[model samples]
Target: MHRHTRRTVITTLLASSFALSGAVALAPSAGAAVPTASCTVTPNASGTSVTIKGEGFTAPRNLNDGESTVPLSVDANGNFQVTRFQKNVDYTVLAVKEDQNFTFVNCKVVKAGDTSGNATGNNAKDAKRGAGDGYRAGRSAAQKSCDVKATPNKNQQHSDAYWKAWQTGADAAFNRYC
Candidate 1:
């Protein structure tokens, strides 16, 4: 074979291989659909308003029903984000599962200006990693049902039943964070 022809064929094959590798690298993986939230709360220096933003909720909600509240939005993925304003009062933000009519989780908002002392909900930092050990023992003993998974991970499968189990475990885990 001619040297130039051989070189051309080799280069073409290399380019094709590189292109295929790049395509595969950019493709989304089939097994990586678990939801996670990087939640954060930012209160203004005056404490009149607080910004709450995060991702990875079954649905985003605005527990506030008062006047002049900022609207929250969820992206294509099930993530919620909102900021609210009030006259230096604490806020309890609850993420309710609209379809299942259950509260998924609670967020406590204490604005910089808040002084009325109405804050509630567990702090995210104090939240326990697993609720099974303590939660299951108490619940199963009382209900006589051990069907629920004791330790429900944050990224577990999303379903009404799963959320119910998680809420059960969260009752105790929630207290740990606050």
Candidate 2:
């Protein structure tokens, strides 16, 4: 067979195999579909920013986990982030699965800001990661590891004062820098 003819035959076979497999139907020549936000959170630093540090994020979030209040953007990736939260705060994450609204709560100390309502279903691992060891608990009176409130945890109970102190510290750190 002619060399050029062999080359053409090889190319045709490769293309046919790809078409049949359909694993990579979208090639370099093809356009990649832009992924939209799925699961997210809003920091709400009120309006300041430095750099948000959460996974599966994009513009308009201004996350800067360092801020007091920032909006978070949730994606299908189920990504979570953490800041030095000293005090106890309330938090919640909303996820939409198949157009059904679902809320996950009772974990974060302060409220986790609502996503722009643009979040779709979240990845289980990422969503669990964002929850953060179950809220800041509180700064140990010794200013050590986090402290937990006397309130009942998913597994146990703690003192309210402990939680209060932790919450106070958290509020100060978050509100001040943010």
Candidate 3:
């Protein structure tokens, strides 16, 4: 009787362990991949404000508001992740960057893949731009281009389209990172 009781107890334990393992195996993974942005912030002595710097900052443009400068989104590598998310039910996150001279703002609006942990859509041209002084120089160049584009009667239709596209991508970046 003792042997039989021991056998029954062992069997029950094994069954319970197997059940638990199966449940765990069937459980859902962390479905969404966390979107990461590369940014370097230099804090002041009091830590109240920071000098935020990154690449892929572009000017915003619209029919009424033409060529206003704003910070574009970046990926894990600090390159501008230029992708648009268009779903009314999606999430929105605010990514604000400010300095003595300018402020870069992005309100990231999420899309299906943006939250799925498997989405891959970043502008290759904007990626791999460098950090630190190189970043500043590149940013200056980009701002210069924007400034040039913003000039009165100097507009190209394709240039306008590009700026508009950059402005649209801010929604996804702000949602994912900010």
Candidate 4:
């Protein structure tokens, strides 16, 4: 009876060890491929803001524009968007995931009223252009705490659309930043 009990104990120990080894073998390796992300940049007709749409990024991502980083959450479909990004300058937009994996794309904001097309679209384009210009001016004004001298762009100062958008932008910026 003693011999039988000892053999049973040894067999149980060997079986447990084998099971543990198998589990380790089935685990994911450290070298597994990291997820990738891709994005498309669409600058509004008015060059003031850009909409960045991305796919294949993991949850809890960040959009970095060199000067600042904005945290973003990927939706269930693994997609995200950064709407109304205010920087007008051209730069590389970096999308970084929580795991330190990242991807990037260059974005170019078109100058206001620079679109190439027929003459009839010029009016609408001009309005958008004016809005873009106004937004930039307003942001500048707000940055100066709305106390800066009015250095209006001679070309855009005449347009009603420009003034309207400029006021809107200034108000928005002042509310947010100042």
Ranking by TM-score: 4, 1, 3, 2
Model 4 misplaced stretches (Cα beyond 4 Å): 1-35, 90-100, 103-178
TM-score of 1: 0.31
Which clashing pairs does model 1 show?
47-112, 47-113, 126-177, 127-177, 132-150
Residue-pair clash count for candidate 1: 5
Residue by residue across 1-178, what tens digits does model 4's lDDT show?
9999999999999999999999999876543323434554566666677666655555666666767777776787666667766655444545564344556645444334433211113233444565566557666777876566234555523333334444554455544554
Tell me, by lDDT, which candidate is best: 4
Q: State TM-scores per candidate.
A: 0.31, 0.20, 0.20, 0.35
Instruction: Give Cα-based local distance difference scores for all models.
Output: 0.47, 0.36, 0.34, 0.55
lDDT of 2 by residue, 1-178 (tens): 6999999999999999978778655443222222222322333454332112233333223232233445555445434554433232343333333342232222222223433232223333323332222233222222442242322143322222222333444443333333
Backbone clash tally for model 4? 0
Kindly report which residue pairs in candidate 3 clash with one another.
Answer: 33-117, 108-171, 108-174, 108-175, 109-171
Q: Evaluated with TM-score, which candidate comes out highest?
A: 4
Q: Once model 3 is optimally superposed onto the true structure by TM-score, how far is the C-alpha of residue 139 displaced, in angstroms?
A: 20
Write down the TM-score for model 2.
Answer: 0.20
Candidate 3 lDDT over 1-178, as tens digits, reads 9999999999999999999999989765543223332222333344344333333332221110122333344445433333322222222222353321123233332232231111223333322221122334334445555332111222322222223233334322333332
Q: Predictions ranked by lDDT, top down?
A: 4, 1, 2, 3
